[model samples]
Target: MSLRLTLHRPPPGRISLAGIVPNRLAALAMADIERLPLAWGKETPALGEFFRVAGAPGPHLVFEGMDARFCDVARGMAAGECEIHGAAGDFVAADLLGGRVVVRGSVGAFAASGMRGGELHVQGDAGERLGAALPWQAAGMRGGRVIVDGSVGARCGDKMRRGEILVAGDAGDFCAARMVAGTLAVAGRVGAHAGYGMRRGTLLLLLPGAAPALVPTFVETAFAADVFLRLLRRHWLATLDAGGAFARRAGAAEWRARRWLGDLASDGRGEVIHIV
Candidate 1:
């Protein structure tokens, strides 16, 4: 069985479980695991104060009875798998170096901000600023993959530098704003002001609903990018195991994608494609 952390005593305030990882805790006994520090606002509490630790650490770590106030449960993990049974608070998997994170429920704002490498899959909606840059940082999401089965809020992929984000549901306004470079695929309608001031990146709108008008600065390109579409399917989407949102959106053999390049307001290398 995988390692499990059951919430026995929910914290009174937000708890920062930043450095807890299976690799480092594999050999720790219950008492030792309890001794691990958790930042509880102004106070530092032992992990055992909030969680009932059971089973030795392994490749998978499961969190049960999570709530909105449980902030930063798996921040900066470099490896292993984490499964959260309930909703997650803000900044989940912030600056993650590597690993796989799956949240079975909704997540708060700024999830997967500045993640370098890994796969983050969220089964429910993501709040504002999903995959966006941190407050003090200029660039966001250096590398990795993020899949949200439900809608995402405003400014998704804002100022992102690299990686891929797939949103199965709708995306809010200013999506991919100021993006340096990345790939964002949205299966549902995108809100207004999309792709504002993006430098270099690819945003795909595969949903059937109407989207906000493209920014005035982005001039439509007449290039037939059949070759690029094939490449995306063969190289990127094909690697997703064919069961996730990526496969559902781009897997059809007859799918056709149209391309538009712009944010000429910036480098002019960015693109927004509407896939039909």
Candidate 2:
């Protein structure tokens, strides 16, 4: 059975649940796990102080009744699966290397920052800087796939180096700002200044009728690369849920896009494709 940790009471302060991934928990005895120290604000406390731990140790870890005070859930995880039954705090799945993490509710800021590989699926919204670089880091989200079922806040994919982020709902302002390389597909509206200062990447905006206002640095291109669009459509079809917003939009027609290439202010290479 999967290891389960159910919060019995709210933490007094922010709790960092770093290094509590499935791979590490699977080897620890119940007693040892209960004794594991958690960084709770200015103090450290045994995990058992706030959570009731149960179930057999295994490759899957399940968290129940978590709230915004729980940070770094599954940070740096390289293997196995971690599931959160409720909302999570900042940096959820940050620096993930390999594995699958599913958050059933909203996540706070910087979710999936510095992630290298793996899949992070959020059934609800994500806060600011989703997949963006951390404060001390230069690049963000080197690899991995993040699927958000709801909207994301500002600066999503900022300074990203590589990876794929699929958003079913709207994205806030400055989405994909300073992006270096990657694919960011947003199904709903994106706020102003989208793709500002982008160097190299693909920003696929799936808004059907609305032509989002972009920075003047981006100039429309006439490249009707039908083959590439077809391939991209195929990829999204396989990656997203068959009945999700992204899949429905992507599968609606033969892939045709009004492409723009620029942020000439930066490297002038990134492309923003608006579906017609």
Candidate 3:
């Protein structure tokens, strides 16, 4: 059902494991990639020197090694189920199109930069710019689901255009800057500029209790009585939809959701849903 792989040696320069996810390996056998593309590493002597491969029999390959030192372990990867037993380095799930990467430990900076589609779940803390766009380019996370079970550094979702990013713990400053679309949910209190300059996108906040800071430019639109929240909770949050999005209360006040339009700034139509 599962296979185990231990990496020890690597190759020279930046070796990319761009196509070694479970879904990517579905068609080919492990032996088929013994020497080629399957498990490429960087700045070492050779592939055999770094990995002590034992179980490569099935479709799933479970690697038990210090992967925190390996960058781009799953870069530009499409579909698959990658479960990292240990923490991962920067660019953990960079450019993933489809599939799921679950890190039992922490993650480095730019965790899912430019991810088109897929899901990345980090059980621990995360580094800077968790879901940010590349330097020089624009747009981050066109489509995907990124959930951090713990805390995160600054600029969690910088320039994110689409997708859903949820941080169960506190998020550093600049939670979702220049966001064009999508949703960013932070379970704990946030730092300054939580949604500063956000063109469009929904920000679901639970902490900093009372009422959120009125940016003046945003219009308060009621969402308490909206039926769409029920759909989102049952589908997106599932058991975690404790907010009013799934609440049983309904009234004019309940339907009131402050709608802030701007960061005009951009040609976007994003929504910010804050229910307290």
Please tell me which predicted candidate would have the highest TM-score against the true structure. 2
Better of 1 and 3 by TM-score: 1
Better of 1 and 2 by TM-score: 2
- lDDT order of candidates, top first: 2, 1, 3
lDDT of 2: 0.92
**Model 2 alpha-carbon miss at residue 241, Å:** 2.9
Q: lDDT for every model?
A: 0.85, 0.92, 0.67
In terms of lDDT, the poorest run of 10 residues in model 2 is 244-253
Error of 3 at 160 (Å): 1.0
Error of 2 at 74 (Å): 0.8
TM-score of each: 0.94, 0.97, 0.79
In model 2, residue pairs whose N, Cα or C atoms come closer than 3 Å (at least 3 residues apart or on different chains), thus clashing, are none
Against the true structure, candidate 2 reaches a TM-score of 0.97
TM-score of candidate 3 versus the correct structure, residues matched by position: 0.79
Quality of model 3 by C-alpha lDDT: 0.67
| Per-residue lDDT over 162-202 for candidate 1, one digit per residue giving the tens place of the 0 to 100 score | 99998988999999999899899888888888899999999
Q: Write model 2 residue lDDT over 1-276, tens digit each, in one string.
A: 699999998998789999999989989999999999999766889999988999988999999999989999999999999999999999999999999999999999999999999999998999999999977888998999999989999999999999999998999999999999999999899998999999999899887886779999999987955688788788888877888655676677765679999899999999899988
Instruction: Give the alpha carbon lDDT tens digit for every residue of 88-125 in model 3.
Output: 77888888888778787888888998888988888898
